[model samples]
Target: MKKIVAMVILASVILTTAFAMTGCSDRVVLNVFNWGEYIDESLIDRFEDETGIKVNYKTYDTNETLLAKLEAGGVSYDVVFPSDYAISEMIKRDMLLPIDFGNIPNFIYIDGRFKNREYDPENKYSVPYFWGTIGILYNKNMVDDPVDSWSILWDEKYKGKILMKKDVRDAMGIALKLLGYSMNSTNDSELQEAKELLVSQKDLINGYYGDEIKDMIANGDAALGVTYSGDFMDLYWDESTDFSYIGYGVPREGTNLWFDAMVIPKVSKHKAEAEMFINFMLDPEIAFQNSNEVGYTSPNTEALRRIREESPEVFELPAYWPDDSIVELSEVYVDLGEYKTIYNQIWMEVRIE
Candidate 1:
């Protein structure tokens, strides 16, 4: 009788363990890839709690890096946040899957201004995320000058105190714009002129950097740096930083008006779950939280309305919300197709020599 009782208890424990393992394996997991420091992480926790889907979040610094990872194809990403030009290139390659709007009902909250643009004109493949301009962030105490033009970056007096983005298109675009050529210039002569301008300005550049430019500028390590407008606003308004000495500017020659958006990759294994996540992000409340935390202009009309109503000061600052004149001066990026190789080679030469 004692041996039978012990055998029954052992069987019960084995069954319980198997059931637990099966339950764990059955839970849905969603994989997301995005730019570093671009999202509000608490939203991820909230999403997991509400939907019971596990999130595996990762980040990359540049659009080029994001493209490379997707093309290499070892891991599958359910969702990716890429900029305008990159999205255009991916769509041409059929690397992204068309998002099902029926599953993303909250997309109606997206502002119309952000929709039907040159990058994804029909809004077939991507949803607008955050939109901002590329410009200069500077230390007022370190330099006394009208922060108005791209030409100031080349001034010999500020040499070795200026930092530029290591990004290829942005660096090249600045030179292109300064020379009165289109940022998307495809002509060999125009591109070469842009390249030559960058090469000439190399001596004045203290260093080329990425997201780290925020801290470096805030700490007064460098006087001036080229960065996204949203990044500058985030650092400038940070409670920990002394705001009186910092300033941001969009050059008179114009700049890239870039948009970053979320898209489901063709390699996604969980399309439905991905759509659910995208829909959740598009929710007005979630979009507001994300924009407030990240310091970028939200593309959701409702979210922007809430922000403007609650924090009216943001609208007063041109850096956070540029006026119409500035908007008219800005241009969006388009895929360069084969011309990208020439730009890449030019970027390589600029970086190496």
Candidate 2:
């Protein structure tokens, strides 16, 4: 769900059946599990062709869902894409395996700020895929005022015209931010206040959604809602000062910048092949194609340069060309354990209210 500002690279396939005869005994095929529309279809084909190893492309909606499936240990998958906080949880549970950085030399192209992040300190396990901040994406015509703050979501005049996400870490995380608490706050009272605010504002919502928020907004089903920054470009509008105006911003206090990264699962059968696929994605050409196709930021330095050069138009978008204040926006989110439960309970209260 972190893909509001996401994208990936392309690759050619390589199918060599050396010690990889059986999916169980040998690791011939690499199963990649990630979010829908998170990668380029052409890249998958290229990976299959270049590796000669079968590429099993799968998708999941949330990090929680992906973690649950992996924890069940019912399937054999080599790699997975998970958000910043979820990566920490997996690392603590020892569910992830350390990467052989030697196999991923293209990783050298990544930006340093996204590397060795707190959740992935030393970045020994995960590699950043795409990242984005949480903010309200609203139609400029409907919003009526500048939307540089989170308090606007609670305005009474906007009653029954908002769309909020069903996910706790996100929707609730925004609610917490509006209360002037840390996005990573562990305080019980601060969380309780956020819960109350959500409950009060729930009725103002026209709908609660997940992936459909884009289509809904494009069709004018709602005025504004909490959304990932990456999804803002696709919402809806016309050539004129027309159908809608898509705008996004991190709140004044700050916002959560979440990154989804590719990681190897400890139970993977194709560790080597999985690493190859990751490196293929790291290739600058692949990154350029992936970023251009997906409309998200590339953590790959070289790929970003290509994107800026060829498609100067991509740079003109406000969400893509974030304001200087975005630098002030902090990198934070609630942790994995019990507070997760507290978040879920508050979500339920907001939903049922």
Clashes of each: 0, 18
| TM-scores for every candidate against the unseen true structure | 0.82, 0.81
Task: Judge candidate 2 against the unseen true structure and give its global Cα lDDT, from 0 to 1.
Answer: 0.78
Residue 336, candidate 2: alpha-carbon lDDT? 52
User: Cα miss at 192, model 2 (Å)?
Assistant: 3.4
What local lDDT does model 1 show for residue 315? 79
Model 2 lDDT per residue over 118-188, tens place: 68887899999987677777776677877778777788888888888878777767777777777666788
Q: What Cα-based lDDT does every candidate model obtain?
A: 0.89, 0.78
The reply for model 1, stretches above 4 Å from the true place, is 1-25, 156-160, 199-212, 345-353
Off by over 4 Å in 2: 1-27, 48-52, 199-207, 236-244, 334-336, 346-353
How far out, in Å, is residue 242 in model 2?
8.6
RMSD of every candidate to native, in Å, equals 4.5, 11.5
